[model samples]
Structure formats: structure tokens, C-alpha cells
Target: MNLIDKYITEVGKHLPRRNRADIEAEIRSTLEDMLEERKQSPSDDAAVIELLKEYGAPRKVAESYVGPRYLIGPRMYPLFEMVIRIVAAVLFGVMLLVFGLGLIGANLSGPEFLKTLGNSALSLLNGLIVAFGNIVLVFAILERVLPAKDFEKELEDWDPKELASEPEPDSEAIGGPGEQIVGTFFLILVLIVLNVYPEWLGVGFFDEGKWVIIAPLLSEAFFSYMPWINILIVLQIGFGIYLLRQGAWNMASRIANILLELASIALMVVMLLGPSLVDMTPEKLAGTPLADVADFFSKGANLLPWLVLGVVIIISTIEAAQGVYRLFKSSPRSPYPVIK
Candidate 1:
């Protein structure tokens, strides 16, 4: 095709399907009319180049015809990006865990190991592509179907009173919105992995020239608490998104954080005090190298639950203290500036 035809074709590619032909025809006619007024020959390549340059790049021309086109608009773009990142991170973690298990079971050597790594890389790439594609598709549809006014209304619904920060003699920022976002993202991932794909938590062993899959390390007791755990995770994720949107923590969010922490502490207590939380049964360990360490596993298993419980208690206490401190710091009589 000639310069004019090629330029029109490029622009047409970006136009909506229904109006592409009409828009392309109009653009072509306009360009031809402009060239005629300039007394430039249509067959002259230099003239066409100069005219096309003045008309702008094909994308710019297409955008002009389309008028503010976006698969996902600016208002929703940040949330879209955040969701994509969270999904990608979760998929990466799942793939990494699977690859590690495969390596353990394959007993691969030299070239075999390299091949496994190559396969893993390809798998991760494909998985990410599918994940990101789905997320983008969902957001794109929402962009078109969800009314802009509704989103505006949602943004306007926030209460300024929620952001009242407490005063302290030597107050410091507890955690930024970024940190909360990252934390909640990983928390969501953990919840999904633990509940939806518990099998991925298992170890793999090569036995008798064949690969064997072990049961998950976590016991059935862990699964029993998943419903409640999932609720806590969802609440935490909502709170994190709120923080991200608001760009700062408020009195309400701090209280919610403490309550979530308390819920977590309560859940951890139930899990730790419940029946053996390890599924290291002899049958499960049989024919694996771990069988040799059965006694060690037993000993560690007995102490592991208590150790986890203690850690959770310590963290929860600290978080609760911080929340209380922040509440007191944001007192009306305090001289420190409130977040609102």
C-alpha cells in the first residue's frame, strides 16, 4: 500500500469496529482535501510524509476520532493495577512452590534440572499471561458497563471523621498505606493458597524410581478454621484498600486493625490448642528420606504449635498497643495535627 493507504489502515486499527470504515473514509477524504489545498501531488511520497506528519501519528488521529478511549479509565486504573499485581504475585508464589516440589520429587541431574527450570519459567509466563488477561478483561468490562457517576458517588461517600489521628508526645507514623497494601495482598494470597490449593503445601519425594506426593503439612484442623480465617483476610483486604484510597490511616481503620488482630489471635489460639496440627503420620512419611527424621519431626511438631502461638500473641499485643496509643494520641485536647 502507499503512504496514505498505510496511514489510514493504521488509524483504522485503533478505531471501534462499527465506525472504523466510516472514520477511515472521513480521515482519508480530509487528508486528500488538505493535500489538494496545498497543491501537493497524491503520488509524491515526500508530500504524503509531510502531510501525514502534520496530521499526527496514526494513534493520535484514531484517538481523536474515538474521543478519550480507554480500556480502563484513570479513576479505576490504580485499582486495576493493584489487583493485577496481587494476582501475579499469588501466581508466582504458587508456581514457585510447585517448582520446588517438582525438583524435590524429580531427582533431576545436570541437564534434567536445567530443563525443569526452563519448563518452570515457561509455565510461570503462561500462567501470568492468563491471570493478567483475565484481570484486564474484567476491569475493561467494568470500565464500560459501570457508570462513571456511580464511582464518583462511591468516592464521595468517605467520612472525614474516620481519619482522625491520635496525638502523642513522640508520635510516629504506624504504617503507611503502601505497607498495608503489601501486607493485605500477601495475606489474601496466603488465604487462597491455604484454602483453595492446600495440596500445593505438600512435599514431594522420589521413591522406588517413582515420584511420590506427600500429604500437606497442615492438618485437617487447619482446614476447619479456614472459613473464619478467610473472613478475617477479606476484612483485612477491604481495610487495606480503604487505606490505599484514603492515602492515610484513620481512627476507624486503627480500631478495625486491632479487632482484626484480636480475631487472628483468637483463631491462632484455637489452632494451636486444637488437635495435632501436623499431618506427619508414619504412613505419609514412609519410603521418604523424611522417614529417617520421624522422631525429630514428632518432637518439633509438638513444640511448633506453641512456638507459633507465642509469636502470634506477641504480634497481636504489639498491634493492639499501637492502636490504643494512636487512639489516645488523636485526642481532641492534643496539640498534634489530626490526619483529617
Candidate 2:
């Protein structure tokens, strides 16, 4: 009802809801104690204002309680910056691709070419802005929802000797927040594209004067493996989420990663050895301008599945091998040589 109540109310406005009451009470108590110690009249409005001024502004006082708040906090800022850089690069690449495709079979030094370039730049700028906004929103949500203890421990528990010690085979950095976030994002992109926009697998070409998409490029045999492939991908996504929460890798995660990689490799191997994954035939393109090269491309299409699956299998195998070796390999992190 008085000046002090008004002051404390202002301070409470800035404090978090969870701690507002306790903090307001503490501030009131401290003010009262100071007034008692001063041996002054509680009704002295002028003296109370002076005391409040000494304590600092309401926002400043609240800040003292909560520390600094951010849309993206210190711990996640590095990852946010990295994601921004990646998104910017991807957008630039997309712009270049669009511009390059437009330049194809067109006069390069014309007004139309300049117009096309301008349109591409505008599209790229819009894309960059949207991507940046979405990334900030996601990181802001994560900053609020994620627990702080794991990050706190990572900061608090430090040993300078770690730099000198031999790298522990189990001490994998896959659980680093930056990598986990990037990996999860990439996996989700792949999941959406394959499941929701499977037609994107088709090749794009210019026909007559317009861009055309030649779809139905993948065969039924490829769709048959989707269930299994989706399962492994979903499992890996779940595992990645767990690791991000943990903020450090452990024995279980190491083992789980190897198993997932092996499963992927096995599935890829089956796709490679079994029925053809591509469905584009010479007959399919007979009506198009590509008819002349259709036969050559048809043969290459048969080999395309092999090329794609083989590359995936090889990468998976290499990753799995690393995980397996690390799981079994143990070496002392000693600075001293064996005395025996």
C-alpha cells in the first residue's frame, strides 16, 4: 500500500514466477531490516526512496536474482552460430544451383539473364531469413526446455590433464550438443524427403522451354525396404535425442551406434544385391528429347542403385568398424611410460 510495497512490486514483476514470491519477501525483509538498523521512521517516504535508489533499479535487483536471460544462452550460442553458418552456406549453394540451371541453354549477356540472377538472389535472401528465424525459434525452445545440470557439470568438471592424457577410446564426441543437433536435423530432413516427398528422387530436366520432373524413378523393391529403413532411422533419431540430453557419450551409446550402423549396412547390402531399385527404362523416355540417350541411361540406371547403395554401405561399415574397435580397445591415459 506504501512506497516500499510499490518498489517491491516493481522488482517482483521482473522476477521469474517460480521465485517471485520468495524473492519479493526477501527484498521486503532486507529493506525492513535496513530501516530498523537505521532507526528511522517507516513513514519517511523520502528516506525510503533514497534507500530504494541505493538498492538499485527494480530490473537490476531482479537481474541480481536471476542472472542474465537470453533467447539463446551462452552454452548453446556456439552451436547456434555453427547452424547459422551451415544454413547460410546451403542457401548460397541453392541460389547458385538455381542461377546455374537458369543459365543453361540461354543467352548469358542478356537482360533476361540479369533478371533471372536478381530473382535468384531475392529467393536466396528470403530463404536465409526464414532459415535463420526458424533456427532461432528452435534454439530458443531448446534453451528453455532443456535441463541445465548436464551443461553445468560439463563446465564444472574439468581436468587440465585431459589435454595431455591419451584420448580414451570410449570418449567419443558424438554426444556433443552441436553434432547431435546437426545430425538430428539432417536425419529428420532425410526422413521427411524420403517418406513424404519420395518423388524428389526423380531427376529434373529442361524440356522444350520449361523444367520437368521425371518421377517414378524408384522401383517397388525400394519401397519394400522403407519400413525397415524407417525403423532404423527413427531409432537412431531417438538415440541421438538421448545423447543430446546426456551431453556426453557412454558405453551404451557407443554400442548402440555400432549396432545401428551395422543394421544400415546390412539393409543397404540387400538392396544392392537384390532386385534393381531404379525403374527408369528406355521406353519411359522415348517421347522426350532424351530418347537418343535413353538406352545408354537405362543401362546406367541399373548401375545407379549399386553406386548409391554401395557408397552408403561403405560409409556405414567404416563407422561401425570404428565403433567396434573403440569399444574393445583400451589404453591407459598415462603420461608416463611403462616402467617394466
Candidate of highest lDDT: 2
Which portions of model 2 miss their true places by more than 4 Å?
Answer: 1-169, 206-211, 331-340
TM-score of 2: 0.55
lDDT of 2 by residue, 1-340 (tens): 9989999999999999998999999999999999989986668998898889999999999999999889999989998997888677657766776787777545577797998899899999999889999999999999989889988998889878776653333444554355566677768867997899887566556669775676467888999999998998899899888876665556777889898998888888888888888888999878777688988878887888888888888888998998888778774366678898
lDDT of each: 0.78, 0.82
TM-scores, one per candidate: 0.51, 0.55
Regions of model 1 farther than 4 Å from truth: 1-64, 92-124, 142-295, 331-340
The residue-by-residue lDDT of candidate 1 on 203-235, one tens digit each, is 556678565556567787768887888898888
TM-score (C-alpha, index-matched) for candidate 1: 0.51
* Residue pairs with backbone atoms closer than 3 Å in model 2 (clashes): none
